[model samples]
Target: MISQNTISQVFETARVEEVIGDFVQLKKAGSNFKGLSPFSDERTPSFMVSPVKQIWKDFSTGKGGNAVTFLMEHEHFTYPEAIKYLAKKYNIEVEETQRTDEEKARADERESLYLVSEFANTYFQNVLHKTDQGKAIGLSYFKERGFTEDTIKKFQLGYALDEWQAFTDEALKKGYNIEFLEKTGLTIVKENKRFDRFKGRVMFPIHSMSGRILGFGGRILGNDKKAAKYLNSPESDIYHKSKVLYGLYFAKQTIAKQDNCYLVEGYTDVIQFYQTGIKNVVSSSGTALTPEQIRLINRLTNNITVLFDGDEAGIRASLRGIDLILEQGMNVKVCMFPDGEDPDSFAKSNTLTDLSDYLTEHAKDFIQFKASLLARESKNDPIKKAETIRDIVNSISKIPDQIKREVYIQECSKIMDISEEVLFSTLAQIHKKDYQDANKKYRQEQKAFEVVKNEEYAKPKVDVQYELERKIIEILMLYGDRTEQFEDLVLKEDEVSGDLIMEPTIQKARVFEKIYLDLQEDEMMFSNEKFRELYYSIIDKLNQEEEFSTRDFINQLDQDAASTITGILMEDEKYGIDDWERYQILPKKKTDTLDQLVSQTVLSLRCFLIENKVEELKNNILKDNVDTKTIMEDVKDYNDLKSLLSKKLGKVIGSYVTK
Candidate 1:
């Protein structure tokens, strides 16, 4: 259990924008900031952050929350984990009770696996830096490969001791369960005895997006002819081979800043590039690039430059990954190093500027690269060349961007010497077929889902009435404390000393005060759970500030709250700077656009409530006919509502209009 004092301290000191900015590249959008959605793959930004409100929302996903909620959603963190994450981020001390043995035992399996992986990482680093053999062997090997001491430490490069039980024994003695070790693939267990999985090998820890160690990649250092050159931790709950990209934890911020990613194929390649001053780079670690990995990078930036070895086999194996990237709506370029030159070796020998310039000058779009590679093989053969063009066009059609697809089509036609019309026609046929298949599948899924829902119970209509009322509450929450100067009518109570002093008529004067007091007098509290949470948060902020700006609303609020407030403030309603502008712009005559929207929303909800009350009144009247006074009171209440509506609507919009 976290202490209340610690929670309060975290809430007080933690800034929403600062915490979210570490993961997202937020740019100023009006009073708030907007960026590409981290929850989904998107080419254009749909995620927004508001610092003042201390919330974030992804319009694409419809997920909104405070800072802790954002972390819990984005990183799949437990409540405690999210709090600890924020505490670590803001440099606040987390004061919490120690977990009991039962609590530890009941913890998530994935978290246990992550713990094992972290243990293995720390053990490996200790062996490499502290043990003589590890230093002499593994450290020397990394240094020989041109890895500097800082680079080695930064990447947490380490070597497992040659003895099989060295890591397993230490982990067991430290109270790390041997079962978790085997589950995380950190230890190979046999006959109830565990042995280190990467014995006598150099270790490369694989980390999740939030930088928790998930697994390891090991390279054999000995001259064992039968041994594989490298081995990776078996895919475990915490480490999915397809989704994990090495170095993302270190490179995410740099990638967002650079607005591009340098994609390589190995752990060493990532480290070497980083050592050479190219920071926005990550590795697929020789696994076939997956859409999950591509989306991870897409969350940071839209552009990806795939660096592959110039070997024929290497290029062929990697061609398929480019289409995978394209399917995710990312802009991909290919940079092939010279034969026998991998990114690791290439970066080791060249300066950052030279390598960057070479990559810039030589990188080609996937279509051109594919065409060039295949055209060489299909030279002088019309049928094979046509087949090659179709293949290139197929990849081109996967692009979601129409302009990008068209540009690629033109380039493919020019390269293959085919007419642009022919290539486009081929692309259209392929795209139409794919789209139809996808739509059919989607419709079938929807039908199946509806059948299930209808059989169970039809979903309740989204409480739009409740939501509209909530929006009104949100507006009150945001501006409730603001000093709104209004010309209020007041009557003078006393007359100055004079023989014939006369009482003056009522006078109107501008009075300035907070909205909270007004709402208090009316006896209203924000009635939505999320809105109520935000209301108290705003009150806390208001207490801390002399004057508040909307910028503060976004920047100070949790990322999820900020996102919601941005959507609420910017959506549906039209803005009016001048009173006359409202008349000029609004389509309705009863009131200006903004007021019309507000009134329509409020009245629709109020009518629903009033109708429900009327039904209840009729039920009461039916149950007891002697209660004429009660019936008359209900009738008088309904009349008062109608009169109020008449004043508001300028004329009665309902059937019960009374002049």
Candidate 2:
């Protein structure tokens, strides 16, 4: 377990914007930072990070929390893992106590897998550097590829011995569990006999964005026609091939800094580019580019330059990735090298300046690259040319931004000697078809959801009191620590008879204290359990701590309560500053109007409770045998009180007459 002091130190040292900015590209927006939602697919940014509060909110998906929660949600890190990550990022020392053997045995499956993967990575690196056979095979192969020792070490490149049981035996001898080793796909077990999966191959460790080893890609040195030349770890709990990008850990910072990512095909391609001073490059790792992978790149920047070999296969791969990038509302460019030269070869042979110049001079926008490539193939054939135009239009239709789509359409029209009008018409038809198909799929999914819901109990409906309770909770979260002078009604016990009586009093206290005491005096409670729990917790913290920290408060709550409070606090920030003015709506700033806002919210809740009582009184009057006169008197008194409260809120009360 991580020491509390270390966790607190991490929380204090880590800035929400800086910690999140490592994984996201953030642009300044007034007092906060805004970026595209890393949790969802979004064109315009809806993710907001407030450095003052040390929290972030994704308005698009409604996920928000402090720095640790953001990591837990975005990167799927356990609480300890998130703390450790922050500690490393901020250079804070993490002091942990050793776990007992029983505790270690009871550790969760995912953490065990992570430990196994880390051990395997270290073991492979040791083998490549320390063992004679590894140096002879793995080290020599990397050296032959012109990879420097520093580059090899930076990427954690390593080699596995030729013997099948070399790695598995060593790992088991180290007392690492067999279950995790097999689960991580580091060891293959057949009929109770286990051997290494990547035997006789050089290892390339694939890392998560946070630099944890998720899996490995191994390249077989000796050619065996029957065996696959390149092998990747099978899918596991922590590693999904489609979602893992080669060299993302190394390239993420550079990618965000440069505002562009260079997409290549293999692990060596990424390494070569990084070694040649082009650090912002990643690979699809020989898999077909996936939407998940595209979204990963989109998080850092919306600009991708796909580096391709001059071979036909490379051209085909570039074409395949272009549409996916465009669909994600990203700008894509293509750079193809000379014939028979891949990124790995090209980067090795050329100087940094030469390679940089070649890329700049040769890189072409996707539309132009596609048009030129297809136009060359369709020379003197009108049918083929018409087909190529349609193909280009199809690519253009996938673009989400209308302005970008129009720009591409015009470019294609000019390049193909076609009219812009004709191209626009084609795009419109394609969009219409796509819209119809999407609607159809949505309806089918909705119907399926309805059927499943019918088989389960329906969720309880929320009452009006729920919103009122939520508003109160929101007030406590936003302004609980501020001192306020409150006129409150308290109950006093008579000394002689011990009877409780109401006493009107005024006190200067924290807003949280005033609200809590006021609620207690009224004998009122929040209708929602979550809101009630959060309210009490906030009050308890305010009473105990000298100064309240919103970030610290959020950390102490469970995920659900933390998320709920975040949604409420960040609700007003959803609207951009210009949006209100543009729409002719002038909302008062909460900081400037806190006193009025708090009083009004409290009055609103009281009025809602009074309205409920008034309705109950009327229901009693409708009963056949009830005391109508007494009920009428009670109703009149409550109505008078409600009217006075409504007047205090700057609103006139409507008549309560019933037909």
Candidate achieving the largest TM-score: 2
For residues 1-659, could you state the per-residue lDDT of candidate 2 as single tens digits? 89999998998889988989888998876677788899987878899888887888998888998988998998888889999999998899999998888977777999989999999999999999999998988999999999999999999999989898988899899999899999999999899999999989999999998899999999999979887899999999999999989999899999999999999999999999899999999999999899999999988999999988888755765687789888898999998889989999999999999999999999999999999999989998999999999999999998888898999999998999999999999989998999999999999988776555552357666577888788888888778889876544445898888996545466687888767765664477777888888888888888898788888888777887888888888777777523555476776676665655666677778778888889999998878988999999999998977776666555211111110
RMSD in order of candidates: 6.9, 5.6
lDDT of 1 at 82: 79
| Model 1 / residue 445 / CA error / Å | 5.6
Q: In order, what lDDT does every prediction score?
A: 0.75, 0.86
Which residue pairs in candidate 2 collide? none
62-91 in candidate 1: lDDT tens per residue? 776667777778778887787787788778
Superposed model 1: Cα runs more than 4 Å off = 1-13, 90-108, 439-464, 485-608, 624-629, 648-659
Q: Please, what's the RMSD in Å of model 2?
A: 5.6
TM-score for each predicted model, relative to the true structure: 0.81, 0.89
Error of 1 at 377 (Å): 1.3
